[model samples]
Target chain A: MIKVERLVKAFGRQQVLRGLDLDVATGSITVVIGRSGGGKSVLLRHLIGLLRPDAGRVLVDGADVTRLHGRALDEVRRRYGVVFQGGALFDSMTCAGNVAFPLREKLRLRAAEVATRVEAALTQVGLEGMGSKYPAEVSGGMRKRVAIARALVTEPEIVFFDEPTTGLDPILVNTIHHLILELHRKLRFTAVMVSHEIPEIFEIADTVAMLHEGRIAEVGPPAVIQASPNPVVRQFIRGEPERAEGA
Target chain B: MTERPLPLTLRPLDAIGRWAIAVVEALGRFGTFLGQALGTILTPPFKFWAFVDRIHYIGYRSLLIILLTGGFTGMVLGLQVYFTLVRFGSEAYLGPAVALSLIRELGPVLAALMVTGRAGSALTAEIGIMRITEQIDALTVMALSPIRYLVAPSILAGLVTFPLMTALFDAVGIFGGYLVGVELLGLSQGTYFGEMQSFVDLSDIMTGFWKSLSFGVIVTWVCTYKGFTVGHGAEGVAKATTDAVVLSSVLILVWDYFMGTVLP
Candidate 1:
């Protein structure tokens, strides 16, 4: 559903994404695993048309989103839903309001119809009847669920999760991953998630891509990636630090 | 090869040059931001409800502060002008003096400054928080223009509210002057109002109107721009809010001076 070709991005003197290439299959959950600040979020931003690549192309459904802007870019983005690390739910809005936002903004649904979808979305995320509660009034786990509900309410063709499980407890992380898996099973949206959850991500990801030094070091199915011989991949999966020079 | 550093005498010049360049660059960015914001605001698919919500937030909510400030300012003017005029044996001119100051200059300038401290700061902090927390990004991914969703409405509200609030301030201030000059200071009620009626004209009211209208744009433009471009994190938001309020206040005063000089 998405293809990135030789994507290069830089911040001042620092080069973040250097000739990076990635492909996301339709109806597949692709979890991009990398070290913190390895341009994971930056790459995701490029895919979602939030960041313009210095030299590259991001093609979604055969159209290069990198070249799109204004109404064209917006048309492409209309099919996209993003979940930021902080949930990014509007604090002033209730959970239901947040979920209903995309629906109301994008679709010309009646209030009754919007409310019905919001209810279903909340319930789907196991937060039934919690729509009226403000984001601050909810727990961290509940907030993440609300964000997911908001993202999925529109039934987007593509959903990008930028560390949606970060800052959550291990149990909560597992719960979120399971919830994502359940949703994927039901809706089958093409998802590109940036996470560092290692083995936990492997369970839910149809394909796992390990990013190292601004490039994809390895990418394959979970079992294939687990058995890969690449030292960077092995070291990362094992959660080991780099060896000393000459060691 | 290693580069040589500038001498102490030249270092200050170098610093000054850099400062000048930075200021010019900032001005350029602000101009571009203003253009884009205006463009979005003028485009179709207008957010009528959002605009109305902001009108309430920026205009209606600011009523009490405008009233309080206007009243006190008029009262102070009445007191000071009475004392001054009494020395000249023209204490009856107190009403005209108070009315002219409030209507021509103080009304718009002070109202804008007050709104800057009140609504402007809040707007910056609100948008800055939204930026840092990724809500702005969320809006973008949802295919919504944050400028349209946020900036345009605020600017429109500012343009609408600034003049109205200034007028309110002027009215309240005139009344305040009446209370002080007529009731407290033993000035004749008819003479006080009668002198104001004779002295104040439509030209003076128009001056205040033009000044307030421009001040509205300055307040909303600077505050929204600061918030939209806030750096990052809580510290970034704090700095943006402080900068927004300070810059808006300064610009209001400066613009007031320019309008006072330029307008007939």
Candidate 2:
């Protein structure tokens, strides 16, 4: 379980989070949705210890991580796998090398065992047998799978996806959405996804938290979020009402 | 987290605050850089050849210019000293003067300065580009140390190349002086060779090699730091490449002075 308390972060004077709070239950898929620059990414960055809250604390299993550093912070980071908005795969490495990187570098595994895990993770992400290809040789959708494979290679307790579905066509987006859902079921990752794509994301997320005006406007199940009377929520949902209906 | 807003005072205090933040960020980068480099030694998924490639670029390929510059250096020194020696009816002293000068200081320092410009700048730009593109970050998340993978091999190459290049400079320079003194300055080969052999000392040769080894290390260190420290985008990379060469060259000169003062 993870808990956030009175989180406050500021860039100079532009306060992005003001006394914000949220919680994640074990094995739950929590999707954070918001407008652009609404600090959704900021909130996620804080969760992984990438960004320290200015005036609050992020507690993972009751441990305050706001002031953690060095090996302690790295241990916190190891608990979660982050897929950056840009995929952030090492370009110089081949697809398999990228996927196996954490295993080779961070985990102590036999070479043969590392190879086995890489193959398994790649197969899990539907990228089996494309090991030697570089990131450039693959399509955008394939790159995300590689990043996903990288995230899952270590079988992290949690996986944070930052704009995972961005820049993909509808079919590819759905494929990724399904991949996310299937990955959660198979790997049991506590998924934390941040996106501005409101409606369809809920299909994969167990719960939705609409980040607005620096705080979660509402947080609940998909059905509760669908019936929300909040005007900001209404406008965002209706703007993509057709997508939701199709979903 | 909600970040607090700052008022635009544009005051001296604000300037100081900005400077402090910048210093802290630089220190943070240095810590990351050192850790990554040291980490490479232990981390798995190592790329042995990538580091060797960097060294090859910085060391082996910069040879032609080192040779040409070193050859010309000895020739110029010989010509200048010949004229001075002639004024005192001692033209034969040109050989010993040129040999002593080349062996002690000019050979290693000048060759290293040139290599720093050529190879150091290239390495800095290449790594800076990698850094800006988040390639370095990608390496870290993979648990690979960028320093161990990229820096250690280059350091090794520098250690080997600097001494080798310095020897080339010393050899070419002395030979160039011999050509000018015996062929152009009207000094006999026997006289030139005798004076040169008599004056050259083991300590002088040792000083040059020490400077060469240290120079190689400095060139790579500065270049690697600049590349790794680049914070901005392409503009940051460009600035870092220029700074790498300029700072390393300046430091080489400073080291040369200290080596000269203390080594003898």
Candidate 3:
């Protein structure tokens, strides 16, 4: 339910996103794969109205979020949930408070109702009985889970994951991916995730888009992308460095 | 090879020009941030609890320091002023001297400096950490204005607390002066307070009030803005905190001078 058209963003002399175009289908998991600092997070920020593009437009559900500002931008963002790489849980808040924040702020529900939903969200993420603990008190894996619970608590129409599994161990990475898959299966929220999980992502992603040189080099279903003819795609999937010209 | 002599003709001028431009740009950004923060305070759906929480943080928590510093400052004034006035056989004027300095100048300026060291640094570090950690971004994506949730309340609290704290400082400082002049230095108690009552006027009180009010806004504004615009990483937060405190302290002193010159 999101479309990025000719999105161009630059930082001083360096260009990060150059005429990058991407489309995210409704209620599907679209994982964007790219090299580190290839503007994946920057692109995601633009989609979520966190960054204004230097040029081009980001349309979510037909409204050009690029043009929206102030209250209008906020209104559009209300439907969005983002899980930052660090989880970004308010450190001063307990796990339950973090999850209940959006509910309390946006929904203005009664305290009893907010607590109930927070508990349900925590339970859904296998974090039951962990609500009272502060984010600092939790393990890295549990923090990520808490972040996910916070994101999904509001039942947002779309969720953006910015390297949610970046610093986790292998098993925890798999666990998080599986948890995301399960949640997607249940909630059916449209997801646009930026990740470097490679083959692991192929199993969960409805569509995989490979970003290269500030553009989408390849995009298709998992099988199609795996078997693609493009050398860049092939090289990336094989985890090989650039070959010498004649070696 | 011998080192080449640096070109000194236009370099200094160019450096000055660049510095001037940078200063102007920073000022513009700060002004815009102040406007936006104040606007958030004026807007609807005001977060009353957030404002109260900040008052507790920036105001109530700062009481002990203000009192301690104020008391010592007054005692110092009493000691020094008594010695100076005694030389001229004008020791009777010690009360007015201590009272005027504390009420009109030292009270607001020193209290602000103290708060800058205490609450201001913490505010900057807290918000800077939040910025680097993406908590601010999280708030944004959740459709919450970080300015409203963070900046507005802080600015409001500053506005509320600065003057009140200044008043507290003035009172305690006067008492401190009384302790030193009348009790320690053998000055008559009635003469000390009676002289202060005769010389200190409402205008002098108003001067401190105005100065403290402005200092409050400056401290909170600079601190919050630095945190909100922190560069990146741990280093960024550290630098932001340092900059916030340093800038707020400098601004407080500078503003105090300007106000001192203008106010009655």
Q: What are the runs in model 3 whose C-alpha is more than 4 Å off? A: A244-247, B1-22
lDDT of 1 by residue, B1-264 (tens): 877999989999999999999999999999988898899988888999999999998888899999999999999989888999999999989888999999999999999998888899999999999999999999988888898989999999999999999999999999999899999989999999999999999999999999999998999999999999999799999999999998898888888888989998
Pairs with steric clashes in candidate 3: none
**TM-scores of the models, in the order given:** 0.95, 0.82, 0.95
- Scoring the B chain of model 3 against the true B chain gives a TM-score of 0.93
Give the alpha carbon lDDT tens digit for every residue of A95-163 in model 2: 999887788777867889999999999998898899999999999999999998888889899888998
What lDDT would each prediction earn against the true structure? 0.93, 0.84, 0.93
Cα lDDT for residue A171, model 2? Answer: 89
Residue A52 alpha-carbon offset, candidate 3, angstroms: 1.7
What's the distance in Å from true for residue B241, model 1?
0.8
Give RMSD (Å) of candidate 3 vs. truth: 3.7
Q: Which wins on DockQ, candidate 1 or candidate 3?
A: 3
